[model samples]
Target: MSPPLRIALADDQALVRAGLKALLESFGDLVVAIEAADGAELIAALKATPVDVVLSDIRMAGLAGPEAVRCLRRDGDGTPVILLTTFDDSTLLLEAVEAGAQGFLLKDAAPEDLHDAIVAVARGESLLQPVATDPVRARYAYRDQDAPKANFNEREIAILRLLAGGYSNKEIARSIFLAEGTVKNYVSDILDKLGTRDRTRAVLKAITLRVI
Candidate 1:
């Protein structure tokens, strides 16, 4: 049998950490190998133990979750990290994605949803909680209504939609039967046309401007 996926849990509240650890252990396919009260402790735990993924609370007292993910990315650590937050704030969610989090989930997510997020992130798939989707859509609704439409070809539009749906470049290429390098070029064009610096902003700008 394949070994269980090792997860590191980080949260400032002791009870919250205990509860999350218990819940992850209950999944049978998951094992909590490290626990930390804040992002610094999380980094230390990572240095001490090899883990498959990290699950961190977004608003801890020290080195917030997004910052930790950024630090990991800056250091060339590609381990997938998932961010948990209490509020369904789209801005924070986007920041987490930009900071290299593979998943964004609310603290009150269902046990099954949390488990599924862990699994998805481990597989290099991206996910955002369903409850958080509408608010983001709503937040961009006014912008969508007011913004001038930018020109996008059919393929670019399809790719933009997939990007907004959290599909990685490899996944997008697979879905559309395009070469990965070609997809990268297309993504660059999309970003240039949207006047955004990165994929997250490109997707948000596309949505806000109704370009996709």
Candidate 2:
């Protein structure tokens, strides 16, 4: 038989952690390897024991969930993370995903949804709650798909995706085999086409428009 998936739980609230632990344990395929009160504790625990997945709260006392994911990613830890949040903030969702979280779930999600999310995320799938889905769809609903596509070609889309990951122009150039100046020009064109003045805004807009 396959070994149970090890999971780490990180939430500021003791009661919430207890409840989540209980619910997760109810699924025989999952095992809680570590429990932490906040993202800081989670980060520390991660250094000790490798887990199959991390379920973390978005807003914690220190080192919020997204930041923890970012830190882990920076440290070359590719463990899947599922961020939990009380509020369905679109900006937060985007930030969490951009930070390398595999899933974003609301605190009040159904037990089955949580279980399925954990399973899916641990297997390299992504999950975003409906609260984020509606807004994203509504925002893109008015786009004219039949109209001529924006001038962004394949290479520009590749560069924009790297930019969204917070890579520098030099790094992006290295990634796509282009000169730094060429990458800079592409970035400028991307910003102009997306109607954003800066790289951060360009990424956010691209995410909003599902361009990257």
Candidate 3:
């Protein structure tokens, strides 16, 4: 039989952490390897033992979620990190994405949604909470409606198209014949103009606004 997906969770609230542990354990194919109360503990736990996926709260004591992600990436750890947040602030989401988080999930997400996200991230897929989807779409829709006289430029439109196609910055650069740094700059500009947080939100917003 295949090995179970080893998992780790980090959250500041003890009750919340326990609840998540219970929910994750309810899945027979997943194993909870460790739990941390904060980002520092989470990093320490990771150093002691590696896991397939790390589900972490974005706001935590010690090192924040984004910082932890940066540390992991800097250390060349391939484990996927999923940021869990209660708020839908676009800035936080964008920062986490720029920090190299593999997935973003809302704290109120359903157990099944969390499970699916974990599985998807474990399998190298990006997962965005469904709840965030519509708001993102709405942000883009508002932009499009407000800009009846003007539309996204060719490069911006191309970037949006590639985003909808699930291309990361590196992939988009390769496909569009642009430097990775240029793609990153465009993504930042896109988020700024569309008023969305992350690439996932940008993609949904682009679709709703018909910008692509």
Candidate 4:
């Protein structure tokens, strides 16, 4: 049998944390390895025992969720983080994306959605709440006026088009008969040229610029 998914929970509210823990534990293949009431405790737990995923509230005592994510990423920690927030502010969402968080979920997201996000991030896929995506796209839509047209060659354009079509990196590589690493490089170039931080943002910028 496949090993259970090891998860860590971090929130300032004890009751909320416990509720989330109970909800998550109901899934057969998920295990709550640790729980923290604040970001400091969360960091300590991470240092003491690593887990496959960390679900953290965006607003936490001490470090806050985005800062904690930045610290982990800077330390080269590969464990994915799923940020939970109550606010639908696009600024916070963009900050989370830039911090390398694998998933962004609302505080009221369904338990099943949380479970699926954990599973998806564990497998190196990004999971963003569908309702959040539109606002995020809108935030980048106006940049097209100031940004230059992408300087991509035909191959790069092909890759960006696939990305805009909602294809994952691996799927794009396969469709184009290119190595995954090659596709990743192309994506990096696309992001650089488009002045965006991530795949979703890049696609949105491309659409706004009419480049893809």
Candidate 5:
């Protein structure tokens, strides 16, 4: 069998953190290797000891999940993150994902959803999910395919898949043998075609449209 996946977990309430730790560990092949009460501590602990995935609360007394994720990605840490939230705040949820989280779950999610989300991002696939379908999240994300066909060419489709995998423009350029500037221009066109402002939203729409 493969080694168990290591997870770094962060949440402000000690009791909540402990309960979540237990629940996560109860799932075989997963372990909470690091724990923290807030985002700042989570980031510090991660810098000291990296893990396969990060499961963090979206709002905390310090740094907050979105800001913390922004910091990690800014410093070149590509570790995938799945954020948790109790509130049904679409704005905050979008902020966290846009800041580089691989996915987010409502704090009340069933154990299997949590387990599956962790495994998905750990394997470099976008969860774009939580197995228990959340209605509030449904409001802003993943509607029926309504976009007019983007008619993306083969190259644009390839770039969209890379974006879903969270590749940076430079990384995508290197992978496809194009200049970074050219990749950026293509991304801009993709966003325009999809009517979204950022790559994360673009990918979400692409998935909804089944274009990627």
Candidate 6:
């Protein structure tokens, strides 16, 4: 079997970091290969040891999650990040995502959800919880409510639901027992239908448009 995916764990709270490390390792498919108390430590540790995913707190003593994500992207390190927050702050969530975080979750999220978020992000999927999604949808709701919704067939709607669930094309393909390339095509069509090239935005637009 392939080795477990390496995870970089970072939080200012030592107990929180320890708890997260234990919980993540308990999954057997994930391993906490690096641990840091803050973003700077996380960044420096990453230079010495590469990891598949990063689980970090949004607020830290120095070099917060958003800035850290920006630094990672600036340095061309495309490793996915899952930012953990204690409260539902849409602004901070958006900042982290805009800075390049692939996933955002509350610290109190269920263990399975946290695991799924990490795995999804590691696979290059974008997953934003409702705490953030609602604001975006409301603010960017369709301009013309009377405009007919895009003619999305049932199959496309199913795919869009999975997209909203934060499943990557590969995962969606496997779940539906369809070919990955076919799923990619479906995603392309979804984006085309939604009139947005960004998958995350496409999902949001679909919700705002009430198509999915």
Instruction: State the lDDT of candidate 6 residue by residue for 38-149, as single tens digits.
Output: 8899999999999999999999998888889999999999999999999888777667767888888888889999998888877767887765456665666576453236
Model 3, 1-212: lDDT tens digits are 88889998998889988888888988887888989988789888999898999999999988889999998889888699899999967656666766888788778877877887788678775654433445454444364464331457889888877766545677789998999999889988888777767666566566666675
| Model 2 stretches with alpha carbons more than 4 Å out | 132-212
Scored by lDDT, model 4 comes in at 0.79
Q: Report every candidate's CA lDDT.
A: 0.82, 0.78, 0.78, 0.79, 0.79, 0.84
The numbered model that scores best in lDDT is: 6
Task: Name the regions of candidate 5 deviating beyond 4 angstroms.
Answer: 130-147, 150-200, 206-212
Top model number, TM-score: 6
* Root-mean-square deviation per candidate: 5.3, 10.6, 8.5, 5.0, 8.8, 3.1
Error of 2 at 205 (Å): 8.7
Model 1 regions lying over 4 Å from their true place: 130-205
lDDT of 1 by residue, 1-212 (tens): 88999999999999999999999999899999999999989987898797998999999998999999998888788888989999978888877877888888888888987887788778766675533455455555544444356478889999988877666678789999999999989988888887767666666667666675
lDDT of 5 by residue, 153-195 (tens): 8899999888766566767899999999999899989998888
Cα lDDT tens digits, model 4, 107-156, are 88778778887987888766655443455556665655555554668897
Scored against the true structure, residue 128 in model 3 reaches a CA lDDT of: 49
The residue pairs in collision within model 3 are none
Model 1 residue 70 distance off true place after TM-score fit, in angstroms: 1.4
TM-score per candidate, chains pooled: 0.70, 0.65, 0.65, 0.70, 0.67, 0.82
